[model samples]
Target chain A: MQYTVISLQGLSTENCQLKTEKMELKEKLIASFMAFENLVDIDLPVHDVRSEAIKEFETQGFPSKRDEAWKYTSLNSILKHDYSVFPKRDNHIDYNDIKKYFIHDIDTYKIVFIDGKYSSHLSETTHDGIDVCLMSSALTKTKYRLIIENYFNKIATKDSLTSLNTAFSQEGAYIHIPKNKLVAKPIQIVHFSTGNEAALLVQPRNLIVVDENSHVQIIERHQSLTQNPVLTNSVTEIFANKRAIVDYYKIQNDNENASLIDSTFVNQKQESFASVHTFSFGGKLTRNNLNFYQNGERIDSTMKGITIIGNKQHVDHNTLVHHIEPNCESHQDYKGIYADSSTGVFNGKVLVDKDAQKTNAFQANNNILLSDKASINTKPQLEIFADDVKCSHGCTIGQLDESAMFYMQSRGIPEKEAKALLMFAFSNNVMNSVKIPEIKQRITKIIANKLGVNIGFDL
Target chain B: MLKINNLHASVEDKAILRGINLEVKAGEVHAIMGPNGSGKSTLASVIAGKEEYEMTDGEILLENENINEMAPEERAHKGIFLSFQYPIEIPGVSVTNFMKTAINETRKAKGLPDMPANEMLKMIREKSEMLEIDRKFLSRSLNEGFSGGEKKRNEIFQMAMLEPKLAILDETDSGLDIDALRIVANGVNKLRSKDNAVIVITHYQRLLDHIVPDFVHVLFEGRIVKSGGKELAHELEEKGYDWIKEEVNA
Candidate 1:
């Protein structure tokens, strides 16, 4: 197969050729490109954007080991053979298969994206205290277009994958909670990826705005209905205005063959509070990026993450906490329990800008390796431009405490039971941070199942 | 009843317990007193099945049955308890939960049913009261942030709850005020009976004033150099361990 390397100044894409003997994939990519051209106006201006994106894709070779962000996990195995980026819409998965991920009775606000396409049929349109709608539809409406155009793509890096997301940004969800108004129930957003013919790439964008003195909760669920190798590139941004409070949770429990690159961006204003809780249990390869920006005085942000990896899977969590104003505080605690021959990586950074005194920032990443083959590479960095700030970071990557394990085992607790008990205790430290009772319980059940412990929670 | 015949143990190839012999019958209290580095604690730990001690040559019999192959918990199920000099602090697990799990595990190993939570709570209440432990203290994490006196008292409380047939108190009287020592000794005395035996391991003879030992044995270089009635403890306390060194030399 012929290959072309596209380059545009500093940004570039590498050339690639089909390795598979199959001849049908060429027709699939051709058809997929044609479908994209048919959906959007192929005018001169739009053509330039598409050509630029494709050129970048060619030059970068679809982001591999050379890329700093994608160093730990290589997508070469994913694109090794002839995989179709765009396949005919399978539509074979029943709605019930994806409905199980939905959270019910959560403030009654629902936004559903089926097969990466926003579905109005499965969503609730009207809400008294919040505005929930699709970004694609909202962009067409003059009133909401201004907000979408101004904020979209502002918080993410200009990488090939993010650019591709914007290049094909067809459907997404936008939620705005008015000032002083509290959403009684948590907003539930579900992203479903379907099709088993080939590789499916789905990018779901979510934007949540909490005005001054407002309170809201957002629960995001990412799942792939098919057992095939699917790729999900998801980005979520949240804004907490002065004195506002926001609690965001992203639960990634997709198929084990699926890979995901999920990022959460949070901005906090004066006296505001923002927290993001992530529980990652599935996926063949997963990377999570959480960035918290404290922009006002007395603002606080916290990031909590728990990752349980087994088999030969790989999971990485990278976080950055920026203290831009004075008297801001941030804390990060991420724990991982790995078994089999899996690998886990955690890279956390905290930056205190100049004049941001009394910042009070702390970061800790701890890992428990259940098997000798399992390994973790954790790095916690702190950059302080201000001298009077209190900042500390620590990373620990080791096997389960043998002393503690022996202590438990000597009590007649079997080896497996003792290990599970210690793991449960290790995970509970982060799970307890979820203030919402139902959500906390649900997370506990997920951890219990992953650790092979029977806590007697009926699903 | 237990017997240790020519017990020899070492740590990292350094001989610590050499040719130590002792025996205890039911309803007998034997105090094994020794100077620092004389392996008094090693004897207690080896009996409790601590893995740090390498048994170079020894044979330990519990009711004439060899127990060298058994694990610590199995030995515990066979009625062996050791009051740690320094109890470990495990965070986020309440004392009640730790005790209940320990008790049920021992019971299960003995083919006994696990106690109900209510019954366990009642037992903990009674034991805490006997040890002067506050009700709220039982709800807190195990030994975390506990005072020295409280930790020692909690050890006694656990001893009361376990009701082992062979109890070994290793330095339980260390770092305690006169009042706290009196309270702890009183608890040990109250729990003593003919069905179970107590082994008080201490450097000082003050604890024996309360829980009197039937026989006091002075352990010198890992062997009992002198054995006598209650008067032996008083003599060691008054004349110091220098007298035992001279006697061994003679």
Candidate 2:
């Protein structure tokens, strides 16, 4: 199959001007590459990959509306800011001040980053049977060289944003689970932007490899400590070996001044199961590019997300599931609630290869618009080359069910609470599949908080 | 202890309830029997303060207080309940959670704290057992994929939990088998007391057989044409609604 790469200049003049401005930012990023490399080890083998990535990003500055893959989401406005590539100093954050961000109800391994640098005082890493440490260590240390050589940047797409992240990759979580070993506790990767700069841009790259017959669960979040403008361009590549099980959760509920571009790539081997759940509640702008590649038969790839936004918040979810082997299955369900002038986009594509016969792929995108100004653009695309495969896609955009509202109101629930309950129920299907009880509860609390309700229950 | 004085209501400029006058005393059961399009359900909805209906005239009094301007939930807090003919299916809320929210909201409106968990659980167990509902059914999503009988029974179960002053069962007997009908009627019978009243709106007398009503009113073309004792249901059953329609037209 052939993929077309549309030129950014083909767009309208307005978009072209925006892209031109972003091109300046891209030059600034290219000029700062030497400074970034000077901070890290220049002799490391990963530096070559970084150099190549920077060259690729230079060739493709930033994707614009002209690109077919970026038709619904535009990055020109966010890229206009002159973002500081690195913070001048390491900001200290007291654990007591930011404890509310963590799921304190349970014990788990945590990899914490403050202002794009690792915070040893706030992080808990393990070096026992499994490796749960920083990507910087994994890149420099000889003990982890084999894993790094085998899996670093292996499955991540070479898009301009991802390439940019690869060019600036220095500090993020790096986990390696050995064969036949199950990680007892879920790992939490949290990056907190202190907002010390006028406008800061942080690129965090994570590598996770779970070997055969092992299981691991990971929760990742990007939070902003202040109202200053902070943009995070993060990339995570996960590889699940044969018979491996991996559950990944992303919680994106930051302040209004914060924006994120998250690119996650998952490669699953034979009989492996990998599920990624993204809960996006608050942000000025969020674009999630989630891709799943099934490399072997009987693999299961599940992608689910719930987006609830109000005000002028904008969220875009662009997902792709590529089924290459026969008998593999993929399921995608996304639910969104847009209120006020908030806008949402869901572009879900499932591609079944010719040899992927007996592949069962189902995709569903449902959204509710609360205000007259709120809008959602949802498209589900299924490309099935195999005649015998079962591939179906469905998309719906609607308001809240009036009858359901009346039912709850008549039962003594107020209008606001009733609407909240209906919205909760609308997204409850995805929440039910969350494996960790504490994480599920935490997400439920965040949703309730977003809805501005103190319903005395867990919901 | 409910009274409707010259009640006239319409929906979208189309008149449905025309000058309805009725009274239900405490410790009494009133069965409002009518054929289709006779406005029986409209009267129930208007009495419960369904906002779609425009009460163009007359007053609805609950315990001698006018409730025409009250919201549905306000009326519910004031001891009014309307069992929907077709219960709405809420896909994600469990039956128990729905009931819990309903009960707590009502309590909070009355300036009372939420019911304690153990007490709430005990009440749920007792009421569900009264309706013969399985323990597993309480955890299922509210009314989603529920059998017709299960939906009706769940309605009565909620009525039992709320213990309202006046409960209106609108077409509750429809879509229910004889066993489910008997079970639901038995649950209602057990909850009936001198301090509360019930208004059963049905086309058939099967439900009245289990929960006997003191007065049976025949409503035709938005007006109550005839009112009698329990024997009126038997007469209406023996002779269909045609007699009542003919009498009203004459």
Candidate 3:
């Protein structure tokens, strides 16, 4: 947010214009909710949920820096964009043009969207052994009503941005794996903003349910196609039943004019496992609110992220693990590399209930600032009510090792390439957790390119 | 051939190598023996163009060209190799892949195309086999989790791959067992040629027994106090560095 100078006498014309624009953006969204209500089925339970959510958004308004949770991130700058609350039309794009962003080297199920609407031509969904389809279908269809009534918006916290996203939740991926079933291939739910509007805000909601003894892998991304400003407020809800496993990855590499505030809520039953890996390398302003609720005993939760960014871009990773039952474990490891004037924030909070005993939680955040102006704010908060819990957290911020640089250079690698190699090695441990080869290859290329080195040989 | 004329260098504003003069001709092996903190490693680093070492007043010439302005990698491309006493561990970069990058970078500096993939692999297999390195070891991260002897062996493996015109072994034998010492010294001897030279920097005479030097020089207080034939190494080992200190103080 740009804080322009103001005279004590009165408001200037430019300041007035920006104020009205932001006010109009918020007012416009509130006004558009009424019109938006007419487009969907008012008979479903989600409609009431949406109605209540919009009211809560109206009461809370957009968050400011005053909120402790948002002390390091401010939305005042992106709010100035006069965003179109709802996309008007879908922009047709060729497959060749957008193919590079997908894991095209391998065969998988894809749920593609243009702006906020599903693009059937580019999607490869399945209903053979699992239900990998659209949320719109799950909401309006009669067969999915029971599941929707039980799981929709069940675990999402009622924060202002999440409430705003839920208020207009429509059109996103919905996957349901039955008991004793294993998804043969990974699922990629990619949202492409055509940037058809002068300024745009798209809200995509995803729901996933994995039954007992089931396993699934899903990848998510949000991309803007043009230089026009785009703001995305997305919410995803996942429920893992007993002995179920879920692996979800989010790739946030959008155009410089785009911003994203993604809120994900994961609820796990007994003996269930859920892991979320976020690769944040782009976007003008990105905030991830990931919350895991271990509602049952013996649940395992994992969170890992690698954020490499430059320019004026900013990324904030806010995570929480709530242990309500006993014998649960959670691990969080996030690494970031910031150059130019970019900034990053990592706020991880872990809470253990009084009744929960023998809980193990680990948190680590390490960062490298390549430029003097680049910065990072990291904090780890643990509130343990149980005396028998085990918790450890550590964070470090520093530059590259000079001796290591000279070591590589003396081996004939240039200074620029040597730095890239060290940076690549710094994040390589997290990459080891990825099971998919094609995804690994894509992330490797992105890291290499971002580090400004070709690395012609395989890693 | 490598030549240094009144070379003066320092690190962090502290003088390390003060008024040091040395010259090594091709086809000759020179041994630099010094006590602890005698600026032996500093000379190796300065010759390899380590940025931390500030060259205050000196001239380093390689093949009649002044190399004071060259970067470490640039000096490396000019065929000067310094085997570090303590090699840096770079995780996620396999030994083979690191050698490939180093070879390609040096070739690129010399305006040559990348070596063919098959030739590179063949060369790697031959050199690795010569150094008795396991095939599995080639794929592990460079120097990460490697034993002391393994790190020293890997340095020689790199030297074999680069085949520099001048090779400086900085305490390459400090951490090696008898078996590993013989293997590492054998690797260095195999690469030594009439067009290349070797500079062995060590504190003891055991490694000098394997990689025998033609000339031995004693460094005291950043200056070569005495130069002599190979017998000087035995005298230093027998009498210890106190004799050199006594001689220099006298």
Name the top TM-score candidate.
2
Interface RMSD (Cα, Å) for model 1: 4.6
* lDDT (Cα, tens digit) per residue for candidate 2, span A180-265: 99898899999998988999999999999999999999999999999988999999999999999999999999999999999999
* Second chain TM-score, each model: 0.98, 0.99, 0.99
Tens-digit lDDT track of model 3 for B131-170 = 9999899999999999999999999999999989999999
Q: Please give, for residues B1-250, the per-residue lDDT of candidate 2 as tens digits.
A: 8999999999999999888899999999999998899999889888877788999999999999999999888899899988999999988899999999999999999999999999999999999999999999999999999999999999999999999999999999999999999999999999899999999999999999998999999898888989999999999999998887777778
DockQ, candidate 1, comes to 0.23
Docking class of 3: medium
Candidate 1 per-residue C-alpha lDDT over B1-250 given as tens digits, one digit per residue, 9 for 90 to 100: 9999999999889898899888999999999898998989888888887787888998999989888878777887788888877776766667777777778777777789888879998999998888888999988877889988888998898889888889999899998899999999989988999999999999999999988999999888878888999899999999999978997998
Per-residue lDDT, model 2, residue B179, is: 94
C-alpha TM-score for every candidate = 0.84, 0.94, 0.93
Off by over 4 Å in 2: A1-13, A456-459, B242-250
Better of 2 and 3 by TM-score: 2
* lDDT tens digits, residue span A387-419, model 1: 899887877766777656545444444455556
Q: How many clashes (backbone N, Cα, C below 3 Å) per candidate?
A: 9, 0, 0
Q: Write the per-residue lDDT of candidate 3 for residues A1-459, one digit (tens) a residue.
A: 112233545535544555666677779999999999889888877899999999999988888666899888868779987788877876788989999989898888999998888999999999898999999999999999988988999998899999998899988889999999988799999999887888888999999999999999999999999999989899999999999999999999888999999999999999999999999999999999999999899999999999999999999999999999999999999999999999999999999999889999999998999988888888889999999999999999999989889998998999988888788778877788887878878888888888778776465
